[model samples]
Target: MLRALSLALATALTVLPEAAFAAELDGRSLSALWALPFAGILLSIALFPLLAAHTWEHHQGKIAALWGLLVLIPMGLIAGPEAALHALAHTAFLEYIPFILLLLALFTVAGGVVVRGNLHGSPVTNTVLLAIGTGLASFIGTTGASMVMIRPVLRANDDRRHNAHVFVFFIFLVSNIGGSLTPLGDPPLFLGFLRGVDFFWTTQHLWPETLFVGGLVLAVFFLLDSIIYRKEGHIRPDPTPDQPVRVTGGINFLLIAVIIGAILMSATVDLGNITLLGIEIERANALRDLIMVAVTFTSLALTPKEHRLENGFSWGPIQEVAKLFAGIFIAIIPVLAMLKAGAEGPFAPLVALVSNPDGSANNAAYFWLTGGLSSFLDNAPTYLVFFELAGGDPQKLMTTGALSLAAISAGAVFMGANSYIGNAPNFMVYAIARDGGVKMPSFFGYMLWSGAVLIPTFLIATFLFFRA
Candidate 1:
């Protein structure tokens, strides 16, 4: 069975390029429609376990075949034959293939190269370290910094079972929240810079809010840690008193710097202007993107195995994230494409909700809703759509506001803690914790945590920072 699955995946990969090229020639409008079949294929894979459960008494192939027919027949009816065919083709190559490839690379590098470390200390000391780590994550990219530091923080508190919640909240604040001050800190804010929002503007406006919430979170964490610390009395000091307290292999810091430089160069460079091998692309952004790609791959190649070896690295967490998110990106592509095309179906109410209060369309509500969606969806496009909408001239009958932009920016960065699936690094932190044998909560369970902790904090943020 595994062999058949492997062969099927290989065949799909082989056929994808030609299919994409052909569809591109046919027309781009049909691309979204073309992606449905690939979605169905993925859906089948996701549902296989359920199918196997029900059909234990029967042939699995027959059940799968029946399920395929049920899915395809309706897809054909909804999309029409030719359009559905094109959507399937587009899905196979454009949507699913690229997504799967990107995930494979991302997880491979994370598991193979990044090291998780252990720190020994009191719970109070550990919580402070966690706060510091969160602050550092905002300066370096959240995932980049989190992957490197999480293991050590976990190790610091490893002996105390009751204090696991401390790490979970730590990820929420540091890995996700601490990075809001710089565009380089979070991808959504970085995307804003790419779209002409000032690099420092977010920090100037949003930093106060970040600090406010960050302080609140820290206070709560300290109080909680105090309780936990009392339960688990201090351990005897390490007998090897003369031995070095800090671990070595600090040189991996250079690799991190290289990755950051690569990302920045990619964001700023225009490759289209360079005549590389007679291909004059003329866009510096494109060239920068290429440079980033090269740098990322190069860092992965050159990282020492011994450094990663210390963490007991494995591919499990990233693999699960890759598989699930691949399907999510595909399923949501059509939804986003329709939103972009202005179909105005389910999203219309959201549009109405954001219409301005006094002759002008405020878009504060739109900013929040869009930003809310951005937390779970790709925050980039979510930011782009709302940015354009909020920035559009009111004379032209489009939404507009400076306050709206602030709301959008704040909403995008602040409420990203709303769920585990709300942002990329949220799951990365969860994965790292799970890998360390810390049984992090399930999706809704994490949401419950956020709802209790982050929701009121955000309300304070909206009132103090974003309210106009």
Candidate 2:
């Protein structure tokens, strides 16, 4: 069954040209189909909450439903139901939004059930754990390592009422910035790989920037924590903590491993062959989707209820994510539409401005602008756009040296810590923290934190790594 689906998807992709029929709406030719979806996402973010208030009394669920509607209904309306059906027909199931939601759900379950530790440890211990978590983020994937370690990190700092900002900064560093080293660290980098960038290329050129930023963040975090620790005074360690550290249900880790493996296999596997009974069906992505689905369901089914109860797993975080992100995705559609209509117009000016300057100036401008926009927009696509603009082709640029690519990659990955919306995992970390009972900063409020904390550090990074 999966093989058949794979073949169908492969046929569709092969048949469809990368530059398909260009839609001209409102006197502009639509070059990128993704623009509408982006606009719908942004609009849905604002409208979903209001729509939810009227449709369902439960604010969170309303948000989720509104998000679903925003993403689904617009295509039906604009292109007609047939267009919507066509989209679904061509859309690879592996890339669908629901798959991410399922991963979140599975991680929530596993963290809640199988993982246990003292939610009340020393501030120093908490900071160290956070550093470890952040460092691990780049290795195992920001989301994967984050889900595995966030609960314990939260528990370690539960005693400090005044140190919520500590974890917020931690998220900025570990969950977002720390993932710059390798493709496995972030989805955007993985997409870059699929597009033909070498797998080890990032670490080779970008590792210096990563080390520079990571070291600075660690130093700053230590100083900040030390000062806060002194002011708060000390509380004796808990003697018989409510949730003692224990790893009783270890099988859940296997489930997480399966999900990660599925992601990797899906990304790397070729589905051009392996037909059964002589049906030449090529669905590489479909096979990956099936694997993810199977692992997610199995994880949910096998997780013990007692473990969930202990970990305080609830539907709230996913509900909130669904609601806001849906709107964000919808609202950005028109903007994307505009960009697509004039593919060169929106980004071309920036490229021209950068190219006219010397190498250092071009690199710095690229870093700051890309980093700044990445705060709100999806950094992955933004990275791709600037990356393409930086040099026409990576292979052709042997003479330009690798410094330019290094700068672009660093800006996209490291500066993503600039805002909560900068990366996917940023918000997830926020949600997990809030769920763990630490009230995080609001949308714009987080920006203020980044401005005060990250901007200066980034400046230093630019000078040492890119400028020097």
Candidate 3:
């Protein structure tokens, strides 16, 4: 299946006319049907695992590729070969490759580092662990922190029957809200960095919002967990007795530093560009990706195999992300183009919904609209769409429209906790917890939890922070 998908991509690159450069299709000329494949893929992701678990487990890649082709073929036929080729190359080289490489590097390095001890799963202990994980998320990324920390947290609470909420709150704080403080923490912020937003800009602008939301969420978790702990009684008296915590595979820390440095270097350095298959690839960005790949393999080679084995590290999560996001990137091409068309396109109602009568930018609308879409779609591109909608001038956004940009950034990063599909790490966390014997809530069941908790919290936050 992988070979077949590779062949299709290679054929598109080789045979399609390539001189048009990386150009998007004229979205106003396309009908709304262009979005059906994108919707199809999302539905497959949401429902198939529940409806046809064995088939989805075995042929998910093929399912993803099929939807990608559903868009690519029709798009090429309608838009002409050159534009289709340019779109494919642009999404692949400029967006998908970089995104996947960063995930690969962080997942590989973090997987190598094992936290080999359990602490008592008291309310205070769990809260402290969540806080630590949340803090680390901004530096090493939510995925990295989640991968490194989830196992120990699971181990710590293995004896408790009322601990599913513990992992759910972990998803809320560590996998989502904690990432709002820096570009390195989340893909949306990283995409902003790639688009010329300063690396520290998120840290500076989002600190207050992050603190308020993260602190509130953590407090709520502590209260909920304490109640559950008191009521549930003792389940089995610490199945995996607490031990002195020790961390192994210290070299992966150095590799993580290299990954961050590499990203910073790409953002700060101007290394010109090279044309590859008619796509103008930035040299610095290309170099960053190469370094990321090297770092991934370096961690794999240097870390003791026992460390990874102990962590229950497997390639399944990263592989699933890659295959699924490949389809998503392809299928989203037309949808984004139409969105870029603004009032003239199929998404005109959406554009109007987020705008004022006098045409001035509405900060609250930007926050909720960007966030609402990001709850279902990939947050990075959803962020980019709103960023462009608010005018894609980073300097202008920084100086004059700071709050609007902040709202957009915060919305994309924070509201990703709204659903499992909202952020990449959410599903992985859910899957890991379930596999470890936690009876996790189903898709809608999880949303009921998020709706009950996150919605009211976000309402308060929106009123306090995003109101004009």
Candidate 4:
């Protein structure tokens, strides 16, 4: 099936008539029908595992491909093959490849570092570990921190009677909310930085909200976990015997620094552009991707096999992300295009929710709408949409409009915990925990967890911070 898909793509690209690149896809002209493929893929992800677990387990790639083609075929017929091909190529070269490579590099490098011992999953122990991970997330990325932190977390909880909730909170705190403080932590803030917002802006604007929400969630987790731990009167024998906790594979830390440097360099230094198919990609951005590839191989070459083995690292989680996100990146093209169209497009009503009848900025609406769409769409672009909607002036957004900017930033980063697919690390963490024998929730089941825990916390945060 992959071979056939590759052949179809190659055949399409090979036949382009060496003409000027087709005009960019215009979101305003697109009808809501363009979004059906994206919705189909989303439904496929949510439902297939429940109704046909075996088929979904083995054939997720095929299902993703079918949805992708649903977009490509009709798009070719309606928009012409050149435009469709250009859109696909642009998404591939610009968005999908870099994204996967970054994840691959982080997964490789961080997986090589092992916390060489385990701790008991007492409520205090678990809360402290989560707090550490939450703090680490802003320094390293959510993906980086999750890869480095989740194993120790799993090792600590393996003997607990009710352990799935621990990992669920891990996704909430470590993979999503923890990334709110810095551009280095998540893609959405990094996008803001590239658009000329100050590097320290989110750190300043979001610190209080981060503290409040993170602290509140941590307290709740402690209480719930205390109850669960007490109920777990007789726990299973520990699978991994505890040892003196220390860090191993120290060299991967430098490799992680390199990954962070590569990302910053790509954003800050524009070394001109190189056109691929119809898209113009920066040379420095290309170099950054090469550095990512190099880092992936370097980490593999330098790290001892024992380190990754101890960490229980495998290719499976990254492989799943690679396959699934490729389709997601493709299937989402129209949805994003319509979103880019803003007030003139099918999503206008959704867009309009961010303003008041008096034409004032509705900060609470901005927070929830940005967060709501971000719960499903990729948050980086979702953020960019609302950022522009709030008047794309860095100085203004930084000064007088700070609250609205904060709302957007907080919404994109925090509310990503709403679902598995909301943030990059969320699904990857889920996959890893599932592989490690933790009975992680299904797509909907996980939402029940998030909905119960996160909804109330976000409400309190909104009242304290965003209410006009």
> Top TM-score: which candidate number?
3
Per-residue lDDT of model 3, residues 152-210, tens digit only: 89998899877889999999999999988877799888778776789899999899989
In candidate 3, where is summed lDDT lowest over 10 consecutive residues?
13-22
Q: Put down candidate 4 lDDT per residue, 1-468, tens digits, no spaces.
A: 644654554354433232212465556766666677677776776667668979998999988888888777656654578877888998898777877787788778878888868899999999999999999888777877898899889999999978999999999999989989877688788667656777678888899999999999999999999999998899999989768999988888899889878877886887999898968888988999999999999999999998888777889777877887678778777677667677877778866788788877899999998999788766876787688678668789899999999999999999999998788688888988999899999988999998999999999999999997
Q: Estimate each model's TM-score.
A: 0.66, 0.70, 0.90, 0.83
Q: Write the number of the candidate with greater TM-score, choosing between 1 and 3.
A: 3
Residue 428, model 3, lDDT: 90
Looking at model 4, report the run of 10 residues with the lowest lDDT sum.
13-22
* Per-candidate local distance difference test: 0.55, 0.60, 0.84, 0.83
- Top lDDT: which candidate number? 3
lDDT of 1 by residue, 187-302 (tens): 66665665456556667766777788888988877777787778777654432223234544443455445454654664455554643333333354444444445544654576
lDDT at position 117, candidate 1: 42
- For residues 118-143, write the lDDT of model 2, one tens digit per residue: 76645567667777776767655676
Output the better candidate (2/3) by lDDT.
Answer: 3
- The pairs that clash in candidate 4 are none
TM-score of 1: 0.66
For all predictions, the C-alpha RMSD in Å is: 8.4, 8.0, 4.4, 5.0
Error of 4 at 362 (Å): 2.4
Misplaced by over 4 Å in model 2 are 1-40, 43-113, 119-123, 198-201, 234-244, 263-269, 273-282, 315-347, 357-361, 384-409, 424-445
